[model samples]
Target: MLKWQWRQGIVTLFFVAVGLLLAILVGYSQPAFRSADSGSLSARSGVKIEYPVAEIKTGLPLPSDRTEVQMAAACLPPQRTPTALSFQAKLVTPEPSRAVPKYKPQQRQEKVHPTNYGNRMQRDVHHRRVNNELLVVLHETVGDAHGAISTFQTPHYDDDNQVSYHAVISRNGTVIYLVPANKRAYGAGNSEFIGINGVEAVQTNPSLASSVNNFAYHISLETPVDGLLDDHPEHSGYTQKQYQSLAWLIARTGVATSRITTHAAIDREGARQDPRSFSFPKLLSYLNQYPRPTEIPPCPLPPQG
Candidate 1:
């Protein structure tokens, strides 16, 4: 009976030892199972697991907070760049004037002379084709609009006596078209436009120096009675109406602001400086109202004789 009792106790001890071994094995495998389950759950939830469980167990350092933020930002949609058209949309539109008159072409034979202007030459005396780009040349008639018009009307057979402009704007904002746009008015004598493409001018007459008239659209603003003196530095500045009309006229031409220059700037003879007391900023303010035309209108053919 004692031997049997001892055998039973040994069996009981063996069972307990086997149970402990099984428990230890399960405990050792539990952490791995939990890690795999966590990874699966993160993937299912669309969470990015930057460091693998193996990496963490190997004691590798985790990414910094900033690195995590950068990663998050990288996942976001890209931002759009501001385009030129978008920027232009934000520009302020100028106030409408009280009396915005329509552009009128003066057809009177006295006002419109036949020989004062010529065709926009395709090539200069050097045989080089002038740039197709047109420049807006601002001028101030050194006298009243009527006087300027009269001067243009008078016949001048001599080349040196030739002087005209494409149009003239009175103080009341009356725009009188004199010479056709396709014709080169005798606007700038002994002048040149130093632009991005270098010196720009054409010598239509070998006797005269190169001039910007060949590729220039001349617009003359009638000088104030006070500004009639050539020596005067400035005068009672141009009227608001004049500024508005000038801006309106130029905006339609599709000529860029950079190319809009003064006769004073282009004149090489050093004797010309008519546009006195003009405010460029004021003109630009009004110009901003109009969107730049997509295409510049082709110059109409000159009236057939």
Candidate 2:
């Protein structure tokens, strides 16, 4: 009878130990993982593994803490870089654009100052082609527009070749640029400009003469070969467009209307009479819009001599 009681007591102790261990594990939040079939706890690894009690009961192996940490990190979003963000913005944004102004023939390369075009830009500069502008001389090319422009394209010096006009107007009235406003044009030769009322000098320039080349802005008008010389000219005189362009150009300079004269009027030696078949009435009709003195102021006499 005593031998049987000892076996029974040892069996009770074994069951009691197992029951306590299960209670401890089930009550704790931090799961104590065990091998699929091995009921053993791992050493402290500082990583928690989540395994459902059902999974442990079934036979699925509990993943290691290191593997759990690596898998969790892989699921997080990637960090952004400045360069990548900028590229993305560029793809979504548009570039800025500008509108261009309309083209005008008068403004094409018409420099307000000299030195804008070099002497050799077309050809070398010759003789005096630089002087103070006082008169706006008018002329006729006696040639086609193309021929006149081509002529100025080649710079010259002597009276044989030294020639240029500040501007040229085609039969269609397109004002073509030739020289800067501040430069001299070979418009007048042996020509003289005596200001209205016998005022021959410009400011301190007492030596001023009819040779107005020193102070003139020469503007030429193209002539059709057939219309170069006509007796009592009619349709070939000048176009309305030409008159408009001329007046506009004259106004731009702000020069006095009376100061505006013709190549024929200023020509000296009586050998020149150009800008033929022209109508002063037509030119004045358009030029009248500019500011001009109503009357010429009298010239002061030299203290009654």
Best by lDDT: 1
Off by over 4 Å in 2: 1-133, 157-159, 197-210, 229-235, 292-305
Tens-digit lDDT string for candidate 2 (53-149): 1122222232343343233322222311111111210112111133311223343443222222212111112332222325678988876766766
Model 1 deviation from native, Cα RMSD in Å: 22.7
lDDT of each: 0.67, 0.53
Q: What is the TM-score of each candidate against the true structure?
A: 0.60, 0.50
Worst 10 residues of 2 by lDDT: 80-89
TM-score of 1: 0.60
Task: Write the residue-wise lDDT of candidate 1 on 140-217 in tens digits.
Answer: 998888999998998889998999998898888877888876678898899998753347777878889888888788
Worst 10 residues of 1 by lDDT: 80-89
Best model per TM-score: 1
